[model samples]
Target: MRGVVVAAALLLAAAGAAQAGPDLGNWRVDAASDGQVTASLYATNKLITGNGALGYSPVLTLACRPDGEPRWSEWLQLNDAVSASRKITMSVMVDGTSKFDESWSVGPRGKLLVREGDDGIKRLVSANRLLLSWRFGLLSGRGEADFDLAGLSEAVGQIAASCNTDPP
Candidate 1:
């Protein structure tokens, strides 16, 4: 019984130590096959009231390219299927300030690619929270999601350094 108790205490200590090391809550960074570094974060709050709902939280991704026409790109992956090759109005608030409320093009896979040279990227990098709301036509209804930008700056800095691009 004494040996078993000691082993359990050691295991608990190990688990605590593992949780303490450089934890990026709700954020992921991955490297693509073509030398692109991408950092993504899942929304803390999800909207799932529409038809065929999957209850999936939206994803916000920022990609930095080593060699490409556009050095960087930002994308918002929605939960429902969106009409591709069309523009949709998306409203974004960063740190309680309305940054942008304009039309953005919807790309393949229901991902909305933010327009190039938008100041929203700069605002997002320095924001602590972000709220996004959009409507995918009448059939799809409306959807909104909020993200906790806890470690976003660090993730973006890592991607920027890896791709040799400026941090937004």
Candidate 2:
């Protein structure tokens, strides 16, 4: 019984040390086709799930090159020659499950430059612990339901600071 208790204590201590931020909150955002967009992120246990919605106005511009290569810009510029609008839709799940689908090039649209017709890539960074709800591209163009990242981060910081153990 004493050994079991010691093992349990060790596990609990490990868990406490693994927490990313603070609150086990959620982040959901919505963006209209008008060009404006909203992004949100939050902490849940040691995991953080968030949302990033694109809007209609203010347009979500993509001007970055692939692999930070100069040729990437030229390739993307010429990508227009292959397809029309760089319009795309990207979705990310709470468990770091996300996908990106687009026509022409992902660089101009998805921003991650995923293969065409392909859904997206989802990788478990840390034993389902340290998740990365990140996908550079287009999400929703109207609205959505989830937690906000920017706000959640701020909130987590406050909460995590109060905790004796530091949040990741």
Candidate 3:
């Protein structure tokens, strides 16, 4: 626990970045299910806590340094109903405003999808902690690559709000 805290601090320092309006504080996940799955998740500043029934033990912890850069990453192991983890790399940009994120996941599953332009909405589904389901252009496939949209959205919002409040 201590090591993770230190590492998170160091990562923020080395990057010298800030997230969205939240100021890059530790956020927690609040989720519930049939005493075995996550149904809701909430993140806070002081503690990145999470409550759920799934095996999603890891909650993304973050720390923002106004003088340095800030970065964070966490893998969510989906069990039963969904099995996936996203390793996202992002930056708060020295100026803070917009954030750029790219993630990759691999698993099993397939479906049909309709192709769309530039920013396409891909639907990823999982029934267990080992297989994954995703929809592409009029087709469905399975692999070990996935993205955490919630995390990305939070990160981007934080930076955007920060910039609105005070630009770099």
Clashes of each: 0, 23, 38
After aligning candidate 2 to the native by TM-score, how far in Å is the CA of 143 from where it should be? Answer: 5.9
- Model 3, span 1-168: residue lDDT tens: 999999999999777754323331233332223221111222221211123332322222222222323221123232222223322222211123344443433223311111211121111111111111232222322213222334433443453343332211
Indicate the residue-level lDDT of 49 in model 2.
20
Per-residue CA lDDT of candidate 2, range 46-133, in tens?
2112232422211111111212222111011111111224543434344344543333344544322222210121121111322222
Q: What does the lDDT come to for candidate 1?
A: 0.77
Residues 1-168 of candidate 1 have per-residue lDDT tens digits of: 999999999999999998875556677999999998888999887667456554778888878789866787778887566654677788888888845786777877665646544255677777799888887667666678789998877888888888887787
Error of 1 at 9 (Å): 14
What's the distance in Å from true for residue 60, model 2? 12
What's the candidate order when arranged by decreasing lDDT? 1, 2, 3
Q: Return the TM-score for each candidate structure.
A: 0.78, 0.24, 0.20
User: Which sections of candidate 1 miss by over 4 Å?
Assistant: 1-23, 49-53, 109-114
lDDT of 2 at 112: 29
Better of 1 and 2 by TM-score: 1
State residue 38's C-alpha deviation in candidate 2, in Å: 17
Candidates 2 and 3 compared: the better one by TM-score is: 2
| Reference-based lDDT, residue 36, model 3 | 14
